[model samples]
Target: MTSTTASRPVGAKPAQGSNLSLGSLLRRPEAGAFLGLLAVLIFFAAFGGLTFLKPAGMSSWLNVAANLGIIAIPVGLLMIAGELDISVGAMVPFGAMTVAVISGHYGMSIWLGIAVTMAFGVTVGLINGYMVIRTAVPSLIVTLGSLFAVQGIVLGLTVLITKSTSVALTVDGPAKVIFGDFLFGGQLQVMVIWWLVLTAAYVFFIHFSPKGNWIFAMGGDKVSARNAGIPTDRMTIVLFVLSSTSAAFVGMCQAILYNSAQVAGGQSFIFNSIISVVVGGVLLTGGFGSVVGIFFGTITFAIVNQGIYYTDFDRNWSALIIGVLLLLAVLMNNTFRKMALSATTKKKGA
Candidate 1:
């Protein structure tokens, strides 16, 4: 009884103080992204006033973010796994044309068109992954090759078959309701719902699933990960497939929503998705990122993109603002990452 030491139950964990909890929170991958998002929201709110916070103004960016977020997540995942897939640019139009040609031009079932479009995505993804794995070529170069090839195919087939660069589609059934319809007084798209749902699924997959560790391992060191029996090759292929298929899905949904598909559109996705991923705090060198980070990065970008219109600044300055804001976000992310690393080092040393 004279002993001053407090007794604890066997296997009990030590309680974390508030400072420790905060430190742990800041060490999370999404922490920088969250901070960046908050900074941008505050910045825009100060300049753009209440209108920017309104539902109408919010929807403008939300719609853009939803479309970009879908593509950015998988691309971010690929980047996290130490690979890249720029072929997504071409896959978008390919998906649009495939569905448009099948469903709109030939009057075939929309379901058939959807099926074939997805199949094409899978085929292209498999090719990209196989080439990357087998040839020892850089993933960048491999996807770049597929990007141009798919573009040419889309252009040639659309012109040859339809004699036009654009095709129109009209859907009158459940497909329209699910994929293309608007919600909440038409201020938002159904895609936003899909974006939220997909983001949740990805978060769980990456953070909670056993396979998620394999991704980090692959990104950190493919050779070592393979040695550990992580099935790196199959994981790479699956990531490629997800990236390509997601791009195709976005294109398909766009075609469905707009009632038309253009062979020339969707090229911006390549750069845009990359920008979103980077802004989300994924390291370009790989092995670090979170779906939540990508999600926040996307919303941050959409805000910077559309927030300009709501501000008093000149419209021509939008691009400049976007560039500056993105640069700041990247810098913030890097700073936080370094701090997290330093904190971990100190703790380990302690």
Candidate 2:
């Protein structure tokens, strides 16, 4: 009888050459995102002049990207896993308010406030994940429900206890230095450091670790992945928790940095994070994306958003400019993705 495993020798190397060619590089998921980032950066630099490239100017967008990226990475992961978590919109303000109310209004310890804020974030995330998994409802609907519910809670609780929609916080010592302070002549928020560290961790987790493949598999086909013995349910819950908690973390830091929290301010994060993820090349339909892509995409969006201020364009036209540029970036990313796929197909046929 023929041996079942005789097709190839154990530990044998493939006959093909190394995959370090330019074409192979371009086939990477982050390649298009990098290109898009370059295009936007050059476009802004050309129009906005040297001032746009200055350290101060760069910090403007980098700071914005840092805050948004923290949320976008996890949100993108959820998207890649065929899920969405819009509850982050409310989680931002909820986190801000939680920290503000505890540390500012009640005169509690800053550490206590941070701990409570994170705990609340974890609790809400757990609820969101449990609801989505058990109810069989789309994550969009579940998070949407939580979004409004959280918003209502923030408004009601803030008004009931603080008697105002805005709360002021004054953080000192280690908390301020670690979470809310600026670095390098007060131009860069400490959040940038956190964002970078977290992105590196995520890159390692998603690309190098075994669990990363499980996430992609879950995104590609959850039922099939589960049947293949992947822990789809647990992973889904973990992603939801990450998304919600990241949003809250961003908000908590903002409250500390700005020294105040408002009830209505964080709604912008919802669309902005989604736009960043999509522009980074994550498909709205899920199953394809990269952390590096999301990082570049966030930077691209931030540049487009802030670069307008440096140019002579009318402030009113900023919205139009941002929309058009983002649309073009998305198209470019799609084109590159198609090219990559075509190259792979041709190679396989050969």
Candidate 3:
């Protein structure tokens, strides 16, 4: 046999140019989002001054990101699986009220309250999943209907039980310590930990595991995915359950954090979470995005949304700026997608 040389390998292919090259790096799924995040950070640092960079200032957006990210990540995954769940808006309050009504109003065991709250999440999630799988109705329409249905159920039940729209609780023991308490010099909420853990879990599930390929294939084309032996129906249902349960978890965390729940407060979560997911680089059409991209996208949004508070800009113009920035971000994501695909095609041909 010929002696193997360190200088040359028989079967190894040459490097596809430098890994550190701009084209190479920008082709990464998270590149567009990373650049967007950087731009926002620099812009905010310029206008928001030193306080904006301080821990106190950081907390302002980090806290917001934690709450938004928890929802956005799952929504992004659902989108990647080619689905949507606007019902989460109603699920949030429904979950909180589940706990609030059972434990707070009825003075039941807090443990029971928590269990029942999550149980309802499981129930609604199953319902949402089953309807989506069995029916050809677009997920948007299905969830939209569920949104109103859940909202009505919540309102009617809360009114019937507590006789008011607002319900309150005083969380104590481990529930407060684990779910609601602040940490790290009393600035960061414990929810941040939950967000990080879940993000990693999703990243692994969607990126490192074979299941991720199934999700991507589902988004690429459910028909083809099923033909390839993937369980599209079951996957869709599982994703729906995850999305709904995530919203409920966030709702429960909020209830524990603030000791209150309301019928109307979670509506903003519907719009806000979608905004965060879109900004994070998850295409509205699905099958294209990353957990990291969504993570950075969330921070970008939080910075822009919360940075306005630290700047001298008029509050009224904030919405306009947000809309502009979001459009620009989507444009950037689309452009990068084209470039990445072109580059890959060229490489294959080469």
Candidate 4:
């Protein structure tokens, strides 16, 4: 729905950039996650001992974190902007397969395939945004539908064209070098650089720009945001499109890195991304979160998800541990929220 500049609550100052001070560090959005990372490290080191802190071990965990963090950052932005796009789970496979189709099966250039993948991403994002706006359906349902529909389409099309569910990609080229090559003494994947760049860019935009305030407003209350002169619909569309496009970009990278794409490869991302976001302290209900928190949260999740494999623990126990982590994260988030609100109330009372 269109919003106009007369409905926002009076006296709403634009969202403020973080004020830096020693005090500010404690109040930093990601402070909780930093503590959580330390806690995780301590727990693993105490239990798994030296193996948990090995360079090779650390690299593996960071690699998974980097891949997931790429998508998490964009999705977190979209969340901050007050929209959702579950279709990313599907978009991952879609983009990868699209790349594979163009570059692998059709003997097309990888750059060309990457471009097509991006274009397809934009199209899918446009459709998602349009459907959400037109029907006023919650994005959860809209994107979930997109998720399944896209998944089916990818599977059906892959089988129809290649008669195989998996495509082996010969990803040796400039595209591979650009996306999949090792950096940081060959201990880090190139995508880690991309993640850091995206995170910094997001932090700058959301913290320093007027448009960032608009995003916070949209999430706080769309109708009120519209009344206050914010273009909620346009912002929503842009956020969704960005979300999808980011997923597609990551998918292309993965296809090149792995040298293959399977229709089912992206399924884990749906939940994994959400877990990271939530652990970062973004409320499921929207309106309050920190991107830096998400960055650390993604790291924490990656450590737990991948690091668990290094231990002698049973695989099933890893799921159990992750579940416990999720529960603890939610519990701590609520406690912190209450504490912050109480402090705010006390200050006003004084």
Say which candidate scores most in TM-score.
3
Model 1, runs deviating above 4 Å: 1-20, 348-350
What lDDT is obtained when candidate 1 is compared to the true structure?
0.87
Query: What TM-score goes with each of the models?
Result: 0.93, 0.93, 0.94, 0.89
10 residues in a row with least lDDT, candidate 2: 1-10
Candidate 3 lDDT trough over 10 residues, lowest sum: 1-10
| Tens digits of lDDT, candidate 2, 1-350 | 11233365566456533467577666667777788788877887788886767889989999999999999999999999999999999999999999999999999999999999999989999999999889989999999999999999999999999999999999999999999999955789999999999999999999888899999999999999999999888998899999899999999999999999988878889989998998888877788889998998899888888888899887687678668767876787787778877986666554
Query: Comparing 2 and 3 by TM-score, which wins?
Result: 3
Model 4 misplaced regions, further than 4 Å: 1-28, 184-187, 347-350
lDDT for each residue of candidate 1 in 150-190, tens digit (9 for 90 to 100): 99999999999999999999876899888887885577889
Candidates sorted on TM-score, descending: 3, 2, 1, 4
Query: Between which residue pairs do clashes occur in model 2?
Result: none
Candidate 2, position 341, lDDT? 73
Candidate lDDT (C-alpha), each: 0.87, 0.88, 0.85, 0.81
Greater-lDDT candidate between 3 and 4: 3
Error of 2 at 24 (Å): 2.0
Q: Give per-residue CA lDDT, model 3, range 156-203, as digits (tens).
A: 999999999989978998988888888855788999899899898988
The regions of model 2 sitting more than 4 angstroms off are 1-18, 348-350
User: Considering summed lDDT, which 10 consecutive residues are worst modelled in model 1?
Assistant: 1-10
Question: Which is the winner by lDDT between candidate 1 and candidate 2?
Answer: 2
Report how far off residue 322 is in candidate 4 (Å). 1.4
RMSD of each: 4.8, 4.8, 4.2, 5.8
* CA displacement after TM-score superposition, residue 332 of candidate 3 (Å): 0.5
- Residue 281's C-alpha lDDT in candidate 2? 84
> Which model is ahead, 1 or 4, in terms of lDDT?
1
